[model samples]
Target: MSFDDVLQRGEDELLSTRPRHSLSWILASQFTASTVTAFSKLILTAFYNVELKGLNHLDNAFQYAKDNNRAILTIANHMSTCDDPMLFACLPWRYFFNYDDIRWGLAASNVCFTNKISSAFFSLGRILPCERFGRGPFQPSIDACIRLLSPDNSLNLQKFTLPPPILRNKPSWVHIFPEGFVCQLKSPHENSMRYFRWGTARLVLEPTIAPVVVPIFADGFEKIRPEEIDMKTDYLTPSNIGSTITVNIGKAIDDNVIKSFRDEWKNLCNKYPNKDNNDDLSDELKFGSEARDLRSRVCDYLREQVAQLRLQNGFKEEDPRFKDVNFWKRYTLSRGNSDPDIQFVGLNWAIKEYQRHVKLYNDKGEVIGEGKSERPSNL
Candidate 1:
């Protein structure tokens, strides 16, 4: 298809026929959010060793768009409640939209009547909402989402689209955590991981507008506390123990790869029905396998594994990866490449696998407990 066709098709498949939440609503929400965000910004979000890596990928995305006049769409992991907010907060606000309009947009799941405060907070800036499945009338809601995302529709673009000078700016990025919410639960002993939705992947692939699908990895927002609500009070820093709360965004992922991964997942599920399929195969396994590259294979496997992880813990396999748990686990142990995908692969692997090892190595290499030799010959 032609370049414009990609955007057109994506819009046809994704946008709303008639927008919801009037233009007035969108503006008022932003107006209200500006005040709230202004206040929230003043409320310092304490930092505990947060590291940002692989931004070169996003930088490249911007540079590519500038050179080619194309756009980029990013799909990130929704492993923490703070995910969506952090993404907007972390981006170069002045580049994508008016710096003066950098406001926190809250889109609560139809909590308009029951949870007014949260609803307002999330539904603000260019606030777009995805239907809460089975909650109520959803077709209308889906249309609203599509309208905002449609290139022809200026409502979504007015806020998200950059100016000509801005277009030449960096890649226009708007983050969508397809998992929809955080991964961890309140209980300390529980080992369940939250599931991911394909909406993220679909947004990347079906849209001809953005050929690159960047994968963002979050290493630790799933910390378990004795009293979950008291996370602030019981905050045990990962870096203190040698692990850093890392946010690694991988290079733009090609659409073809997702096709193969999804195909493999579906094939495996159809072929082998009884196995415990959970994690998204690509992450749990590896990527580049189809490219005859082991590193890619390993990455694809790992992504798949993350899906199973969520599945095992009651969040049924949302992505197309629950068909082969072995492939996912094996990919985790497999040595990976230096590719940016490797970082996303490795980081998630650490979340499910290398956690204890991370705790042992700090700025200064201090072992958590001395070896048996240092134990003074017990008995």
Candidate 2:
């Protein structure tokens, strides 16, 4: 599809999100992504001392997902803009050959899709333009991720003359930066991670089939592209060439834990007074308070899972105060003046708070009611 088509249908409907792509686009995307991956591998090997631990866990999870027709969802903490592609460099070379077996990721729309050329480049690399600030996590792009994690049969492949191999009885692989933005601590020994956004909770809870959830922890990427860079160039140049980068791939979350959480979500929906009554309403509107609470809990649990990896990697225990969203808000506000990205974080938090108090809407373009603005007492 053309860029105009993506604009008209909305950023969420980009051809990259669909099950199939034009042959030319598929070829281009594969070539571009492969080349980039190869280059990243070379850079890491030649310049940095990279250590990857527990790679077997990822291999086992990928194999299990492929055998059982289940999707694999990988979550990691974001410390740099190039973390996704750069981290993949540690994988075996065979992974770079098949585009279907590789992972699809989300990127900030404002940063990655500002123009046609950049949009096409990132899209071809299998990145979806997600609205991080304006829509928060309730936008259609988040819904698309849920659809992707569902069973392969949910996709419509007949529309394309030649469906890509990714559409043929294989589950998609999706990667998410749950922290939502680059979060570099002043000291690498600090165990704290930013509060994971609720978008990730939806990915785990709403999928038709529970995905194989794997958590990854990486360090030293922040040195590659430090938040306080001296250069003002448009290109993403790597710095601190000889830093030691360690990547730890934790085991997949237990299946029983995922099932129990899904069951609890179902119970909440069933207990609601108006479950399934509003077919046109989004889950946020239909399930209302229950979804919001469940999402928060799920996000916290997921964040802790990643934090466990950080501890395993020899970092100190996280500070208890970092668990509170308000703490992060205040922290960001304090740093907003000097760091522009931190300013975006503060603004996004405000926008999310505002959205919570605004009028809710159904898919049919009808206003339902005002949302609750009260923060939880414990929080």
**Candidate No. with top TM-score:** 2
Clashes of 1: 52
Tens-digit per-residue lDDT, 1-379, candidate 1 = 1123233322343332223225565466546545544433232134344566777877786566546544455555555444444444444434334432232122333323135565444544444444332222112233232222233322234333332111112223345554443444333312233334434433332222433445666544443111133345434332223233556666666546755655554454344333343321232222223322332353444355344333433443343332333433444356333222322311332122222212222333333531111111110
Residue 135 error, candidate 2, Å = 0.6
Candidates' lDDT values, in order? Answer: 0.38, 0.70
Candidate 2 residues 92-176, lDDT tens each? 8887677777778898765687778998888788888776443556566676676667665543344322342334347778899
Name the top lDDT candidate: 2
Q: Please give the range of 10 consecutive residues that has the lowest summed lDDT in model 1.
A: 370-379
Give the Cα error of residue 86 in candidate 1, in Å: 2.5
Show where candidate 1 strays beyond 4 Å: 1-47, 66-69, 92-120, 133-150, 153-172, 185-195, 222-227, 230-244, 255-379
